[model samples]
Structure formats: structure tokens, C-alpha cells
Target: MTRPDPADLHPWIAGYLTPYTGRTRQNATQYLRRWETWCGQRGTSIEDATRTDIEAWRAHLSARGVRARGIGAALSPVRGLYLWAAQSYLITHDPAHLVRMPRRPTRSQRPWLDRHQLRRLLDYVDHAGDPAMRAAVHLWSLCGLRPAEPRQLLISDLGTYEGRMSIGLSYRKAGGADRLTVSPPVEAAIRAAVAGRGRGPVLYNENTGTALSKAIARLRLIRILDAARVPHVTPYGLRAGFITLSLEAGVPERDVMYAAGHSSSAQTAYYDRMRHTIRARAVHELTDWLDLTGTPGVTPMSDVPATLPP
Candidate 1:
């Protein structure tokens, strides 16, 4: 019996996955390419794959310093390709299904900047060399806008209605257009930053006058953080701080969800947990109650007088 050529499979897979070309296809292609390389080194074809072969491959990946999540992601395309081949009657069974993915550890709650740190960071941005960078940081800190969303913003997006400045966010991931009423301070910052620049991307490279990339934004943020000597702060951390501060200020969760462009209320819940304001407020109230009861010197519950006669 002759073996099928793996080179012939690329066009078929690409054609089948034409609808998923952007990031998803790119990731899948990377995983598939790695699998092909592995299989070539072993002198095996997809049709000749077996469960034992998959287990050995998993071990090989683990030995190569692949983390559990990376291992899972690497195997995902293999599973999909096997299923596709099975569905097309090119293979008798899907060997990829026999490969068990390692369990990934649960991630801890995300971190957000506290109110004091947030204020300091914004002040630092204000004093930064680039005015556009200052405005961009201000928007992210104040409005909880995603990094990429602000990059695509235009001057026309900022509109004034009933003496209130509002910004329209059209390309949101939440599948609808939403508008945020810019705070007076933020609007002033943006106007001052873009004073001479005509309608285009609001956030642009200081040197090139072109729209900023995520890498450039990240590098600029690192420079700002290093110069200010602020530790553990990222651009996303500023956005998280905006959400946390809003929740602490008694803003309703649904309203925060809208402003943050969160796809679900669960994401808002995560932000609430990170805020820690509710816990702090509860402790404050408890301390106040203890103080009002004339228990300042009390050590523990055992020190309290029992209401029942002893």
C-alpha cells in the first residue's frame, strides 16, 4: 500500500478553513506546521498515526518545555485536522482524540492599580514628552477603553451634545456601537493634545505622525513606567484601574460593563473582585461599629462581657 502525500493536504485544509483566516487561521497553521515537522522527523503520515504515537508526542512536547496550556493549544489543531480527515473518509479513526490534553492551572484574579497609583500614573503621562501619548493614557485610565480601540479613534468620534462631550466607539468587540460621555477633564486633555492635528487617528506616533501599533504602545508604556519608577503598571492595568475606581464610586455594574465594553457580566464580576473596595468598606464599617460600642481597648471576643449571667 502507498502512503498519501502530506503536501497535498495543505490546499484542502486552507480551502476548508477559508472563513477563519485572520488570527484563528494563523494560530491553527502554526500548530499544524509544528505537527508536520514532528511527523516528518518520525517518518510517519497522518493515516499511519496511532494512540501510542500521540502519547509519545505529548511526552516529547512536555520534555521540550511546553507548558500545559501551550501543549493543549498545539494539540487542538491536530484534533481538528484528524476530525476533518475522518469526516472526509480519508482516515478510519481520529487518533488525535486519544491524546489527552494536560489540565491547565486556574489563573489568579487579575491585578488593577489602586486609586493613588492611578492618579500618579496619569500625572506622569501628563508630563510625558508626547502630547498624544498623554491623551491616549488619559482616555485609557478614565474611560476603560481597550488599547486597540483608542488606536482606531478619529477626531469625528468626539462629539458634543447638550454641552456634554461624547465619544462614539464604533468598532467594539461587543457587536454593537456604543458611545461614552467623556469626562470634562478627559475631554480637555484630548482637545489640548490634538489641537493642531486635523481629523485622523487621535493616538499617533510622536516621531512619524502615524497610527501607533500595540508593540509601540507597549514600548512607550514601559518607558513611561521606567521614567516614573512606578512598579507593576501596564496600559491594561490603567484600564482595569478605571473599572475598579468606577465600581468603588458606586457606579452600577451594568453601567461599568457598557463603559468597559465587556462582553458579559461575568467579566464585570472579575473586575469587582479585583477592586477589593467592598471588602475594605466592610472592614471600615465593622471598625466603626466597634468604636461606637466603646470597645477600643477590647482585645478579642473573650474580652467582651457576656450578656447571660455567669
Candidate 2:
């Protein structure tokens, strides 16, 4: 089948994406604009874009100092756009689909805070200068929430059962919505943070009580880590610490998966990999079953004859 004209794209795409295009569409548009600029600079029409052109663009991004992962992120939208255009018959050939995405480098395992470090960090936050900042740290460290989750939390999200506290979290993950149940310590910190406030987000600026931005979360977390003299700690590190601590404390993987609202088995595996305690335990169990050390009266490897006795 012949490809449709590139000029026919705008209207069809805009309508096709209407229902799905809130934050994702906005980001996709920005990426598409960049792709357009690159094509224009090369004196190529959008319809004339080819797999080679996409590959060149990936190389160009890398040459301009973009990281492999960043290149992958930027190209993701372009890939989607071409696929969508193909599906709508706006393009006969999906050049972006033919193009190989840049390989993402393996990220090092994030360093999780030990129990002592977590305690120290929490203690510092408990006495920090700004009440909101203190509360933010408490929520992340104690409750194991992603940085943005706390800022999105509402008053009605909190629940109590038999005097024990818990939080109901509605969070966005893996292109979908998932919910989490917060632990008691996390609930207590949240309650303390918003004792007087009636509604809206739980963690906010002390001066305005407005939602916190990702940048603000990073800055505050960095400050807290620095004050506690904990190295290599990010907001995500706190989450990893929580998973690690939970597994160490004998929490089942299934329970952790439910509590964290993980949507996929792969995500659960990633969490397990991050928790060294689980990895260690797994190795120990395997080694015990393997019986690497020979039993009594059994010849060790060194004691065995070099050649089999006839």
C-alpha cells in the first residue's frame, strides 16, 4: 500500500491522540518539534525521513553530549509518532520503527542507606528548620514513597483501623495508575505534617502549602543527606532502603509487591535485586542445598585421583 502524505498528519494525529494526550502528548510534542528542527536543518521533508535519517539523528544527539539513556528517552516519542502516523495511514513506511534505539547503559546499583544511616537521617529531618521539609523527609524515609507521591497525596487518602494508621496512595506508574497502602510510621509522619490543614496535598512548601516540585524534592533530599553525612543517597535510595529493610525484617515479596503497588513481575525483580539482603539470603540458601563442602567420608575434590581408577 502507498504511504499517505505527511501533510495529512496534523489533524488525524491530534484527534487520534485526544483521549490519551495529557502529560504524555505534551512531552511527545516537544520531542516531535526537536525532530522537525533536525529534519529541517538537514533539508529533508518529514515525508522523506528514512531509517538512516533516524539513525543519524541518534548519532547527532550523542555527538552533542546527550547520554545514551537521554537519547533513548528523546527518541521514544519520535518512535511513537511514526508508529501512530503509520497506523493512521499518514505514512506508508514507519521509518522510526526501522531505526534502532540507542542502547541504554546499565546504571549502577543505587546505594541504600543502612539502618543506622536511616535513623540518623530521620532524626535530622525530625529537627529540621522547615516543617514541610522535615515532613517530606519523614514521608520518604519512613514510608518509602516516591518523591512525587507525597506531594500528590490528599487528606482523604489517610485511614485508621483500630488506632493503627495507614495511607491510601493513588500513584502513576508504568503508564497507569496504581494504589499503595502506607505503613503506620509513614502515616504518623504524614499526620504530623498536616495536623491543621484540612485538605489538598500532604507535603508542600511551608510558606505557601503548595505542592512540591521534583527539583524541590531533590534539593531538600540532598540537604538532608548532606546534613546526615550519608553519601550517595537520593530520594530513590530511601525507597530502596525501605525495600531492603522490609525484606530483611522477613516481609514476603508478595506483600511488598502489594504494598508498593508494583504492576509487573519485572519491577518486583528489580526491587529484589536492589535489596542485597535478599540476594545474600538467596545465595546462602542455594549454597546450603548445593553442599559445596563434601560430607564426611566423601572425598574432597583435592583428595580425588587425577585420573579415574580403573
Candidate 3:
């Protein structure tokens, strides 16, 4: 299929994306262009697209082995395009509105570091010669940043919010601007990483002295874990560990959800259920019950709810 000319697409795309950020506008344009290419193959344009056409296009992509999430991403812009066009009176109906994308598959709990593994990883980063790597590790282990989040930080993004050190986050996968509050140690590492650079991205390619690529960040994590003699884990595992450790240490579920940018309590609870500390505490309570009464009938002390403070 021939690609649609940008000259023909630019005017409509510009108006549709006026409210989006630069990055979002770029993504929307890419997604829409892919749709346009599909339409071109079928001898139609998006302006004449129908619900059936959209559904067939979705099926075509699925037949090509596109994952459910990718199908959703591709369709979202087409939906937006029709909505914008309908609102502008360029089209009488929004065909893309009723077109359904595939349901996202449920994700299982991902792997993460335990206390001993995390401690060793942090120790290695702390002693490493590179300031940028130190900041990257601390952001992962302490502040619970997504891998891409740390790499996207700019010098101007650092600030004080409510008397706590905060990092402005603009590149969240879920979208929207947000902030991450950090402890003094993490803040210090961030400052050290940005030292001698007053602007632009904070995380840098150690060799290129430019913003670190996502691929490079993942590879870097593997090397860092190997050097520290810790077992292999994903950068996402660092984030999961942060949430797990925080909940296990009795941080409120709501607070953990907010800090970790989780959209719901259910997601936060999922991490809580996976924390090893909860099992350890339960085992200790059972041991104590057995030692005290030599009875199998006694409930573990951990099963009792704590009294509220007056």
C-alpha cells in the first residue's frame, strides 16, 4: 500500500492535535498515518471510512500478528480523528467510535529483587565511578521510577515540592505530568548526576554524553546487576520492589499507589500480595503461637487487626 502524502494529511492532523503535547502529537500523527496507509490499500480515505472498514483494518493488523496492545494503540488515533472530524462538521458520523479493539491481556506479577539483592545492587551503584549511573540506580531502587522515566529527566525538572525534593515527570507511559518525591540520598545522587550541566536531559549515555536510549538503559541494568553479583531483574522489577518493600514496611496502600503512579488500589494490593515480608511475618506469628500454647487451634497473632489510635 502506498503511504499517504504528508502534504494532504498535515492540515487536518494539525487541527486535531492542537491540545496534545509535542510527543503525543507526534505519536498521534504516526498512528494516523498507518491507518491512512491501510485505507489507501482499500481504495478509500479516512473521511469515507465506516465502522466496518475500521473493523476490517483491525482484523488485518491482527492477522499480521500485531499484539492486542499494539492494535489498541493503532486504533486510538483513528478514533480521535473521526471524533475531531465529526465535531468540526467535516463528517456527519464518527465511524471509528464503535470500532472495538482487542482486549488487553492480564499481566502477572513481574519478578523483583529481595532485600538482600536490592541492598547489594545499591551498594555497587553507590561505589561506582559514574555519577549518572548512581542517579539511575537510586531512581530505580529508592524513588521507584520507571526505567524510561529516569532516562527522560531534564535538569529543570528538579525542584522542591511541599518541602520535599521532587522530580517533575513528563514522559510517563500512562500520560500526563506528575512528580516524584525523593529522600535526601536519592536527591543527592540526582544532583550529582546533573552536575556541570544546567539544562537538557539529566540521564546521559556514558559514552555519547547524550540522553540515554531505552534499549541502552535496559542493557545497563543487566550489566549493573551482573557487576553487583545480584540476580538478573528487569528495570520494571526495581519499580515493583519499591512498591513491595514500601507496603511491607507498613506504608499506607493509598500512599504507595500515589508514589508508584498506580491507577488503582487493586494494582497496589497486587504488589502487597507478592511481598515476601508478609509471608515471613505470618510464619513468625505462627511459630510464636505454637511455642506459647503447643496448640494447632490458635490463630496466628498476625490475623488479628490492630486497634485504632485514639
Candidate 4:
């Protein structure tokens, strides 16, 4: 049987999701559809779903072995739709307004690589055969670009303002042009990666000559970590580490938030922890580490095969 158009059942859905991307639109539609089906089974319409009805749906998801995170993801669209409808005067109240989703685990609760592990990973990437892969690591670790952000980056995105180098993100997480001040290493890596090309992706597959997909980029990072003997971490975890390190180094909270593409300082603060000792102590203090380049167990770039493997 054909599924009825969600917008047909509720015309507001179309306009509500119109601003979102195709993938997001599809996911939101699916989530709303699930809610619609559940409402019908419960002898109610989405417009009439009470707070109790939403709670029951949550309970239903829990009974089906859906974890808290999964349940929250599925319910997000439902809440969004109701909230939008209420604001638009299509509904008298938002049943999902007071209803709460399960709390996500705190940043400190999740596993992330430490400074030593990150240095090791970078060293491994530097010695890897792919220049694009090495550049990707630098962008993530140094500039804190999201996995997809660097993939969409073009040569034109490289910029300088007030004599400081920066990378302009066209597809920022917040849906606007976000320019991040690049560190020396980040600037060098990006400049070298796009040296010959006037325009195109900063990282691309040599064989395909196309931008690397998120999955492929993630696989490359995993391989680098394995080679470096670092514990497995998600791409997001690398971003978390960047925020954590920057804050620990006494970088202003606003600067860290902007660099990490976080919408709020609170989002950046989640990664801050008292137990994680500062890596760049000299950055916060006047004293300098005698040899910051010499990470334990990793040789200097001069000793490693820095060039792309033949």
C-alpha cells in the first residue's frame, strides 16, 4: 500500500521541512510518518496527540528495545512539527512542548583520544601514502572542521583577513559562512594540498579524482589510528578533542566555539574536563615545552617516511 503524503495529512509539514536539506527532509518525514502511524493505532490524529500520547509513544519505543538516543532521534521531528504548528496558530498547544527526550551522555562520559594518541595519529597520517588523507587529519585536528565541511571545501575558501590566514566554511554546521583562523600547520597543509589546483575539493581520491566520501574519510582515519596504535574514536570525537584541547590551552571560549563550529559556548564547554591535564601548558603559561615536537614513542617527521609511499 502506498504511504499517504505527510504533507497531505498536514499541509504545514511541507513548509516546516522546506528549509532543511533533502536528507534531513526525508528523515523528518519518516519520523513524522512513524508518529502518524502510531497516532492512528491509538485512535488519535497527530493534531490531537496529547502529552500522554507522546509519552506512550516513548514508552512504546522503549519496549521495542530502542535505546534512549534512538528514541530521542525518532521523536525529534514530532516535537518540531508540533512546536511549529503551535507557533503558526494551526494548533492550540504543542503537546510535545513539555515532553522531554532522553538526556544524551555527557562528553566526558564518551571515549575520546588524548593528546599523545592524537599526535601519534597525525604522525601516522603524515607517513601515509595519500596527501589528501594527511591534509584531512590536519584540518580536523588543527582547525576542527567537521568531517563533511572539508570535503566541500574549495580552493576559493582559503582566505586571509587582517594579515591572518583563515579557512572559510561554505557548508558550516550552522548553515552560514564560518571562517576559522588556521594555525601554522593547518595553513601549510592546506596550501600544499591545493598547490596546483586552482579550484576543487581539498581532499580527493587519486583514482576517482573526486571528493572523498564521509565513509571513505572515516575509514582512512581509522586506519591511521590503528597504525598509530591509538584507541578507536569517532570523527566527532576528534572534533571534541579539539575543543577540549583549545579550552585547556586557555584559548578564549568564544574562539574555541567559533573554530569548532559550535552554535553555543555551552556546546563547547561540554568537552571541557578537570581531569584531562592540559596538553599545551606553555600556550596558557609563559614557559615552553623544551621539545613539543618530540612526542613519546613517535619519531620526528625527519626520521619517518614523510613523503607519500611509493
lDDT, model 2, position 173: 54
Candidate 1 runs further than 4 Å off: 1-29, 42-111, 156-170, 173-179, 270-310
Name the 10 consecutive residues with the lowest summed lDDT in model 1.
Answer: 1-10
Error of 3 at 152 (Å): 3.1
In model 3, which range of ten residues has the least summed lDDT? 1-10
**Candidate 2 overall lDDT versus native:** 0.69
TM-score, predicted candidate 1 vs. hidden true structure: 0.68
Clashes of each: 0, 1, 0, 0
lDDT of 3 by residue, 217-270 (tens): 777778888899988888778888888888777888898888877778777766
Q: Who wins the TM-score comparison?
A: 2
How would you order the candidates by lDDT, starting with the best?
A: 3, 4, 1, 2
Per-residue lDDT for 119-201 in model 2, tens only? 88877777776556666776666666676677777777776766666666654554555545555555656777787788877
> TM-scores across all candidates?
0.68, 0.81, 0.72, 0.77
Best by lDDT: 3
The Cα local distance difference test for each model comes to 0.75, 0.69, 0.80, 0.77
Candidate achieving higher TM-score, 2 or 4: 2
Worst ten-residue run, lDDT, model 4?
284-293
lDDT for each residue of candidate 1 in 1-310, tens digit (9 for 90 to 100) = 1322446456545544555534456677777767767777788855677777677788999999998878998888778888887888887888877677788644324466777877777788777776677777888889988777777788878888778888888867666688888887788778877777877777767678787778888888888877766666666777877887898888998989989998887777665644465878788899797675556565677766678566
TM-score of 2: 0.81
Misplaced by over 4 Å in model 4 are: 1-10, 18-27, 40-44, 162-164, 274-310
lDDT of 4 by residue, 93-116 (tens): 788999998987655454666788
Query: Candidate 2, 15: how far from true, in Å?
Result: 4.9
